[model samples]
Target chain A: MDLIRFPEMSRGELRALRQTVDGAFREFTRIWGDPLENLFAPLARLLTFLENLLIDSPWILVLAVLAAGIWLASRSWKIALGSVLALLVVGYLGMWEDTMRTIAMVAVCTLVAVVLGIPVGILMAQSNRMNAVVTPVLDMMQTMPSFVYLIPVVMIFGLGKVPGVIAVVIYAIPPVIRLTNLGIRHVAPDVLEAAEAFGSSKWQKLRDVQLPLALPTIMAGVNQTIMMSLAMVVVASMIGVRGLGQPVLQAINNQYFTMGVMNGLAIVAIAIIMDRTTQAYGRRLQKHAEAGK
Target chain B: MSAPQEQGQAHGIEIRNLYKIFGPDAARHLPAVKAGLGKEELHDRHDHVLGLCDISLSVPPGRITVVMGLSGSGKSTLIRHVNGLIAPTAGQVICGGQDVAAMSDVRLRAFRREKTAMVFQKFALLPHRTVLENARYGLDIRGLPAAEADGRARRWIERVGLKGYEGYYPRQLSGGMQQRVGLARALTNDAEILLMDEAFSALDPLIRVDMQSILLELQKELRKTIVFITHDLDEALRLGDKIAILRDGAMEQVGTGQEIVLRPANAYVADFVREVNRGRIIEAQTIATPAAPGAALPGFTVKARSKLDRVAQRMVEAGAGAAQVRDPQGQLLGVIDLPAILNAMVNSADAESEE
Candidate 1:
């Protein structure tokens, strides 16, 4: 029976182990919780400020800004107009403020992911040991169920925007880091050898040769991170993140089909806008690669 | 020969008993290699590839030294040692009396920055940077002010025949043009040593010849200590003031092109020189017979430095059976007959072995 079914820890032993781990984690949070929260206070403030700015602005002005940004990124009036129409549709459906909050959350989470992820990626690219260590950690981050980690995060930050932001960032950051490392590593070796022969120091090589060459790949990573952040918004709403996700969560609990479909379509609209704008931007960044060929 | 000293003091590079073994346990196998474990045997026995072995050569300043070999012959590895791009397993690279291998990382960087510039086979220009920006990359690394670097870079860009393409990126340029940019970038550094690792091997033959001419023209003015690597015997003959031959990670012979052609050090070199156009390589003086004192000089005269083919053409034009080989001062060095010139031109290893 033990061979067929898997042997397990006795109930008392399992309970004792769980109690010890839970107690230790609780103690750790009690000691470190306030300082860590304070450390993230500025991030929380930035998130709040961006959300407020988006929600409080005249809808027309925000629409105009988004249209201009899309136009600049895509260099096509059609894409910009389509994105503007999609945002207008989301607004007309009465999901305007919730959509704005989701946008703010995704934007802030993507920005933080890029800021923290690129350096980590560069470090991994620079050393075999770092790559060996970080690669498995990234794999685990991507594979681990988000809800399992959410328990600890919610306990520490106590069900607010910061923990939600942290959870989204945790879900989103791996792609950027992995792709940045890949991009930098994929830079032509002969080019790197040339830089070295010309006496470029480590930092100079990274900045001038590796980073610029890796920009297109890094942008792709950024796009993936943004998409992942949006995907995590609903999961994040379960921990008190207020967004279009909240209505979807409510509709799920109450079995309200129209409300769920409307909110889901709104999320899809934003994803398409972001995906097209960023993909276009990434393509533009690699114009030199296509110019002569 | 002891005339007045020239303007710039010659800073020749000398490689002394250098050996490079590739693998984690390279240092452990150095003694066995020094004692002459063959390259194949060492690789088979110890799993260590010999990159270079017991290489000793003097690269004279103000002249091009071409290291010639086919693929896997260690020609590329040999040039990398000069710039400290690859550390030697044993021995020293002495340039301007400074040991390159002994320098600290900081000092090596300073040395490479101040004294060396390298051109690669692939024309490794940064794809993202413009022609002008790429040209000034070395100066930028040295932290030169932007204006000065731009001025110098612009001068070189024009010098290398890339005048109006300042804003164009590398991908926009043709392969030959990209190599031109590579050359301009290296020249812009104004470094003392120019290391070219098969710099034109990737170009079309016509373009390669064009680039070779440009390099020679530039070398006439620059007089930088150039270490050029190539597998092409023709390029080695054309550019090298002194030529070093490598075979299976060891020095085969090092001399003037004519010396190698006339007197190959071993069978491998003899085989390599077998297909060479001997008339173009063997100079008139090298094959000339010593003239007797007060003997009547031949009616046709050719410079001692002129290749036998030119001497032959001139002799044919002058309708003479023989020609006098003279130095620049017009002093007769030797006499060469038409028959001897033809004989030397078609001479091959098999013929010599038969003799």
Candidate 2:
């Protein structure tokens, strides 16, 4: 080793490796560009359409709608009042429009992720081979740094709200899938055997027994997905996706501490509202299941 | 609707050369297993746990066939194979003249729906469904109309003595009541073959006795081909029309309860019957003296099927020295004296001690 001394070659080798990786990716993109665009365009259109619908609504009406949703989910007037108060504070702090945009992004991202993730998770639960394949991918998705996703997302979809939402969906999807798989797999073996003995078809067993029992756990996953969606959407603002994150990003660039603090609080307040509502709803569902028995 | 006719009921379930080996590549070791390799040896040599071994059993219709064994004796596996829940490595499960193991997917599904029902040890009532809904499950799966299914379910619920609890959830009921719902659900299916895998093992002693009696009473009219599995020898004796004893995945012996208790075939069967109350299990036919063709018949009579314990009580109460044993048709088949009944009640313990 002393004789070889490596010739101080590490930097050159690393540069060459980076160049090779970049060339390979470029070639992949050149070959797969059309199919990839076709695949993502519909998703991008759907997300943008939802974003417009939410952000275009009047502030007062939107606030009322959110407060009512919170009330329905939590079944507590006190929680509803707190949510309303938080919304008003965000408005007073001049972050109302930005907060709405962020909420819209999170809602759509979470919805899309759940719709796609649950069935895949069910498939995973039904087959050990599928589960074996999906588990490592899920581990990577959950553990990888959020910043790592933006490069691929922006490179494919280009910068904007669509790319932002795509990033958020990628970041938030694993929890729902993992939890749904776990919930179905964790259903009592006796219950499943009973279903089998009763001549339940595979679909019937899944729908009648597995899904109903797994609902609370899946709802918990939805809550986690929503929370992760919110976080990812804020970070997504770095690539020109406007929301509360935009103001915070601006504040960071220019050292405007007040703007940063206000926007940050707005995001936190939104997180708290969603967390309490979803958790309360999950508890109510569990109680309802118990009472049903 | 007319009552379920005796003809339409399944004749018998015939399990022939049944072998179950659990683990990947289970079939690869079937030859070695059937050739006489032990369960432990199979596991060591081929990494397959033998679940059943050459189990040949005939479960007669219109009777309760109780398969008795301790845990890991493969009784559960054997029962599951009857309903095609578990496939055998090498065997034929002939149910209703159709090979259950050989049925196609669609046919197996239909077989399960139209011909069989099961009562679980855990009383596997759906937690979210009310008692009535749980009872209605089999009918619902059969695609019966809601109104008609509800009526059938309600009747079974009432029959099982869970009348007022139809609207209550499974969690709202006691264990006994929940099992009643399980029974009601199984009955509502009206399937000819009822597979009860340790159906009453979870109940308290008193409740277990009650459920056993209920099952026996209903079975008198239902005449379903019921296969009951249990670890308790007492339960098997009490409920089984014929009992099959299993040990370490192999069938040790199979016969009437009286035959098993009176003359155990092997050490394993003997150990199982060692603590059994022989008086209750030994039928009057086993100890009855032949009635003379022209001799004067006794005034008092006992049923040929009566257990020794019951006939002994009757003889004591009536103060009869001897009683004619009448068959179900009331024909005098034989005579059972008080001493014979007494001997059957007391001699079992002596016989065991001598062994």
Candidate 3:
């Protein structure tokens, strides 16, 4: 019996396997490089444009927009003022442009994640087979090292803000999909029955009944997706995605604790601001749904 | 109230030879089940739960047919089958000449949209929608334009007594009020058939009674063919033109409240009626004697349709030993004596306790 022992395979077969894989990657790049780059170039350009716009825009206008958004979401002038003060403190630490850049990237990544994830989640909710198929894939995406996705992302999009956005999307999409599926599933069966009894078609039920009821849960999922996107920022910075993450990376490399702490605090500020806004928005939607009734 | 006439062309519902065995492969046990396997026997031998068996009944048009049973007696399953929500293992549900169980998806959708409306026990109003929106749901589903649907919904909202609360969402309403919205939604659909599955079972006792009266009041004017499911015998007696009593998925008895109360078809039915107050359900005509030949009628006359309890109340108030029972047109039909009413109320209690 010619069983290949692990140690023996490590000496010769491992090297062979590495060569085969490396050759496959090279051949794949050779064949698919132009088409793939062409597909991603527009997206890359959009990301670059957004990041630069945020970084170069006048800081006062950006802060005003941010504060206004916070105020709208929270329905509280106090929260808006507090967020503005916190953001101004970050600016005083000389990280205003970087903070805006980070916010822009997080925004794009979250948008892409929501756009792609919600449909997938609805599909999963509609069919148990789809859920069974996607659940393990989601588990892998969530639990596997976020850095591991960057390897293939770098190979495909080739080291830029696009690759960073792609990485963030991959990291952030699972929660929305899982939660959206859960939200749809958890809608009371009696309500669905009432809809069916009233002769709601499949599409009508989804639009008028299921999705509306599921909105709060889906919003919670969006909140988690945003948080996850922010968590990916420093890792995304590694592939030349410029943002506040860049300085934190530099601080780590140069062992400069103060720079790391200051940049880290800015990221935290952004995260807190985003989290509270999303949560407040979700609560408002719930209140609006129940308002007057 | 009337004899079981031919249900043909009347837009009534007839469920024939219905049998529902719940299992992964209920079809496989059909032969064994039809050959006289009992519910527990099926469970122990085939690991299958029997949901309904030989549930043959006819729901008269413009009247309520109450299917009464305890929780697992398959009353819910029976009501759901009317709308094709649950398919029976074997049966035919002929509603408006369409075999509901045999309907294809497209035809079934049409049947549901055009022919029927349902009220739920949970008052399943869409929480996200306002009272007006929820009420308009059925019309909206039928593809009516929003303006038309809204107009129809508003009429029903007022009819069901939620006129001022049109913009209110379900969460802001109390339980009884939510059920009013549910009733409004069903009524606004204007379907010929209304299926209510324990529609008032979730309400508080006082609210349940209030809702029941509201339904009775609406039913007088609308006269839709309503199939109402309930576990409460009193509710069945109050609402059902004909009540079908079920036990372990089999029909134990099918009759009017008077018929079932006076002459139970079997032990299961007798047990069910044992706790019922006879005076509340037995109509004046049921216990009325023939009028004294060529004699003057009593001073007070009770309507033939009036229950014995109400008749007793009127008789006691009028200080009469016997009251003439009159048809709706005021012609004397018979006379109900006070002793007969007392005997009915007391003897039944004594008979039940003696058992």
Per-model TM against the reference: 0.96, 0.92, 0.94
Candidate 3: where are CA atoms >4 Å away?
A: A1-10, A288-293, B1-10, B292-300, B349-355
| Model 2 C-alpha lDDT per residue in residues A24-67, reported as the tens digit of each score | 98787777866877787877677667667666888788779888
lDDT by residue for model 2 (B209-294), tens: 99999999999998999999999999998899999999999999999888898889987787777777888888898788888888
> How should the candidates be ordered by lDDT, best one leading?
1, 3, 2
DockQ for the candidates, in order:
0.72, 0.54, 0.59
The positional error of residue B197 in candidate 1, measured at the CA in angstroms, is 0.5
A248: Cα error in model 3, Å: 1.3
Better of 2 and 3 by lDDT: 3
Worst 10-residue stretch by lDDT in candidate 1 chain A?
A: A284-293
lDDT of 2: 0.88
lDDT of candidate 3 over A113-174, digit per residue (tens): 99999999999999999999999999999998987878877886688888888889999999
By descending TM-score, how would the candidates be arranged? 1, 3, 2
When 1 and 2 are scored with lDDT, the better candidate is 1
Global local distance difference test of model 1: 0.94
Residues A11-66, model 1: lDDT tens digits: 99999999999999999999999999999999999999999999999999998998
- Fnat scores for every prediction: 0.85, 0.67, 0.73
